[model samples]
Structure formats: structure tokens, C-alpha cells
Target: MIKLPSAFRTLLGWLPALAVLVFAGMALAQSFQTQIYDPTTRKWVDYTPRAAAKFYNRHGQSPEEFRRQVVPFRTAEKPGTIIIDGDRHFLYLVQPNFQAIRYGIGVGRDGFGWAGIVKIGRMQEWPTWTPPPEMIARDPESAKWANGMPGGPDNPLGARAMYLYVGNKDSIYRIHGTNQPWTIGLNISSGCIRLNNEDVSDLYSRVEVGAKVIVLMQGAALYKGV
Candidate 1:
């Protein structure tokens, strides 16, 4: 047995409680760090995409539901059409034989949600990011990139981008890859649809310019039997 002075024994007895308090404090700090006050919304919002990505990278990938997979999907839309069920955070590339390649996606938050039929106007690899005028006015941070941000791993539009168009006009929205893969399955983007880098690359390769895209927003009629 090891013997210690009275003071040392007392200190040793308090170690477990100290450890619990330390861990609790750490958890509380992390929670606070993950949220931000939104003046426009007058609420605190979860703003932890970067942090979440780091955590998931250390722990594991995003939820199993968000992983890419092939599933039985029945839709009247022809093969090569892209159907996005934003409410469910799933994007399906319609295939022949009542099948589809499904990928988890991050969709528009609250006021930004929309549903419409569009076509792929163009595609780019490692696409540059040019913050829209409205985005710059809304977010000072975006103002720095008003001119443009060159494409790379750190760019928000991770590995690829497919621009959307309504007839001959640009909708200013895109189906793109995201640097923060942890955002998949969450409602977080301004208006664009986001997929993980690997998944986006796979989708980009399969989709062609001028392919039809149907976006179903929340409460919209989702395809049956998906």
C-alpha cells in the first residue's frame, strides 16, 4: 500500500470530482462555440459546419443515412433527370428500371427554400466562388469575396459545381460539392444544394449539361415509393 501525507490524500480524493467538472466545462464551452446569434432572425442558430466537420473527421463520418447508396426509386421522370427531395435531404439521379443513385444533401434553410423545375446550365471542376451582390450585403465576410474566390479544397464549392438555369436565365443556384461534409442531411445552405466532395464528383460525372432537375421543397409533393 502507498501512504501519503494528509494533504496529499485529500487532494487525491478530489481528483475524480475535479475531472468531472473539467469535462462538463469543456462540453459547455463547445456548445457555446457552435452557435451564433442571427440578428435578422432574432435567434441563436447552429453555426458549426466547420467545427462539426472537424469533430466528425476525428470521430467518424456523417450519419449512415447521409452516405451515398443505390436505392429503389420509382418516379415518372426519365432516367438522367435529377430529383431533389429537400425535405428528406436526399437527391436522386433517376435511373432506368425504377432505380436511382441516391446521395445525401444539405439544402436551403427556412426562408431560402424553393421548389421548381430547372436544367443544368453548365458544369465546372473546382469551380470558383463569386459571392452574389445580395450575399455580400447580408454578410460582411462575403464582401471580401465579392470579386471571386479561386477554387480549391478550402472553397465552399468543394470539388465540382453544376449551375442551374430556368430556360435561358441563370437561377443563381447550384448543385455543388461542399467543403463541410458534415452539413449533409441538415438544412444549412442559403439556397443551393450541397453534397459531399466524393458524392458530388460521382454525380457530376453521371449528369450532363441540359439534364432536367426537379426540386421539391418542404411540404411539396415528394415522389411516391422512393
Candidate 2:
């Protein structure tokens, strides 16, 4: 047995309490960092670590529902076709065996939603974002980026972007990664389909230019076979 001086023994007894206090302080600081100001709501929203962790697995990746997975999906579309079910917030890449690789997504809000068949006209990695003229008019803050916002972690397009087109013309819509991972499974974008950075990167690698993309907007029936 080890014996210590009276004062030293008292100090040792307080060690566990001190550790608890230190960890509590760290958690409090992290909670504060999650506070974000929302221009639309005109309020500050806070996301507790526990809430964020619920969406993630022990590996720090999205949970099973949000992570990319192969699931039984019956569709007549050929393999390599992309089908987006806006209401369900799911993007499915059709496979040959009546299965598809499904990834969680964030779709457009309300009136911005649209259903159509389009093709992936182009793709880019860490692409720059140039808010269109209409967006600038609707959002004064976007005017500053009329030229273009350089691609980076902070950019709205987190990692990769696939541009959609109608025949020869750009549809002005995209399927891209979002810096705001929490937005997945929500309806909040202008018209783009947003995926978490990791999932989007995976999708970007699997999909190719000229791939068929069918978007089924909220409340709309599944397109044809899809």
C-alpha cells in the first residue's frame, strides 16, 4: 500500500471530480460551436453533439439509412440510370440484378421541386459556384459571388458536382455535395439534389457524363418503370 501526506491524499481524492468538470467544460464549448445563425428564420439554431451523432455511426460516417447501400429496387431502367425519389429523399443508381445503390439526399423545397428526365452533361471536382442572376436577385448576399466562389470545404458544393442538361442546354440544376451534411434527408435547396460529401464523392466516381437521370419530385408518381 502507498501512503501519502494528508494534503496529497486530499488532492488525489479530487482528481476524479476534476476530470468530470474538465470533460463537461469541453462538451459545453463544443455545443456553443454548433450554433449557427439562419438568415431565413432570423434566429440562431444550435445542433447538439448528441443530435449530430445520431445521424452518424460509430465510424463517424452516416448511419445505414443515409450511407450508400445496395438495396432491392425494381425498375425497368437500364443499369447505370439514376433515379431520384424526391419525397423519400433517396437517390438510386440502378444495377443489373434488380438492385440499386441508394444514397440519402436533400432535395429542393416546395415550388422549386421539379420532375423530369435529364442527362448528366458534365461533371467537376471541387467545382466553383457562380450563383445565377435570379439567385443574386433573390438573395442579396449571393450578389457578391456573381463572378464565382472558389471551390473548397466551405463552398456550397462540398466536393463534386454533376451538371444536368436537357438535350443541348444546361438545365440550371445539379446533383452535388453539400458542406452542410445535416441537410441530408431534408427539403431545403433551391433546386439541386445534395448529398453528403463522402457519398457524393462515391457517386461521382461511379456515374459518368451522359448518364440518364430521372427526377421524381415530391408528391409525384414514380416515372414509368421507376
Candidate 3:
């Protein structure tokens, strides 16, 4: 029978313990994942589920109304046109039958109702929020929002924003991600459509730079064409 030397036996005995320590260290390093920082305050914020859940609960909002504002949609429609149910808070990327990639949305708040067929003219990453001159004029405090608002977890636009445009006009209105995920099912946007940050981020990645976007107020009728 062969036997391990004493020194070799000792090293072998230590391997399992060494492996566990290495794994524990890796996990500890990965514990810090996402960050939300405010340069002005010189602070770093952690994205923890409990903190987010607590913020949602503290807001004077009904939990149901902010649940991504989505409902089942007929996605199998013909591929040429997109179906937007702003009234119902869902957008559908029509396919062929009666189904779609449905997404929850927040429509215009108070006086920001819009009805039209617009194309996605321009797209941006962490878009700068330039308060329309009109918005600044409405309230002097809004001037801070001008000169372009930087993107972050606290930014009203959340992580992503899709700017809707008509021919020569950039609709002051937008379709964007919101920090206020709790406001999802509600029509509480100034003039833009709101989406959960993750959802909007996904949508932004799927849609292209010049995708044709058709936003509708009424539920689309069954398209009866080839």
C-alpha cells in the first residue's frame, strides 16, 4: 500500500478549507452590485430590494395602480404597425396572430393628453432631461431641470427614455422609464408615457433607432388585411 508523505497529507487536508474561504471572499466582493450616486451630495446609494420596497410602501399610492400598467394584448397582429393602448396602459409590438410583447405604461398626467401616429425619431442612453422652455416658464423652480437633467436612479426619467417625434416636430411628450415604478398603471406623466425602469431599458434595447411607433388611445380593431 502507498501512503502520502506527512507534508503532502497536510496540504491535501487544507485544500477544502482554502476553497471555502476563496468562495466566501468572492461572494463578499460581489455583494455590492448597483450604485446610485449624487455628485452634489457626495454620496453613494445602494440598490437594495428592501429599500425600494419600503419607498414604494411609504408613498401615498395604492399598490395596485403602480403595477406596471399592463394587461394581456393581442400580439399576433400583422407586423407592420405597433398597437399602443395608452388609455389601458400597454404597448404591443404586433406580430401575426392576436398576441404581442405587451408592456405596462403610464400615460400623460393632468393636461398632457396626446393622440397621434408618431415615429421614434431619436433615441438616447441616460438621456438628458431638458425641461421644455414652457415647463420652465410654468414654474421658475423648473429652471433647475433645464440645462439638461442628468440621468440616475433619482432622475424622473429613470434609466431610459424614448423620444416620440412627428415629422419636423419633437413632441415635447416622451415615452420613458420612471423612477416611480409605483406610478405604472396610472396616467400620471406630464406629457410622456412612463414605464418601469427595467421594462423601458428592455424596450429601448429591442426597438431600433428609427423604428416606426404608432401610439393609439383606443384598442386597435382586428386588422383585416394581407
The candidate scoring highest on lDDT is 1
Say which candidate scores most in TM-score.
1
- Give the alpha-carbon lDDT of every model: 0.78, 0.76, 0.60
List model 1 lDDT by residue over 39-118, tens digit each. 77899766456645754686577656678889999789999999998777899999999999999898875555566788
lDDT of 1 at 25: 28
Question: Candidate 2's C-alpha lDDT?
Answer: 0.76
TM-score of each: 0.72, 0.70, 0.61
Runs off by more than 4 Å, candidate 3: 1-81, 218-226
Residue 77, model 3, lDDT? 44
- How far is 50's C-alpha from truth in model 1 (Å)? 9.6
Candidate 1, superposed: residue stretches over 4 Å from native: 1-55, 219-226
Clashes of 1: 0
Error of 3 at 175 (Å): 1.2
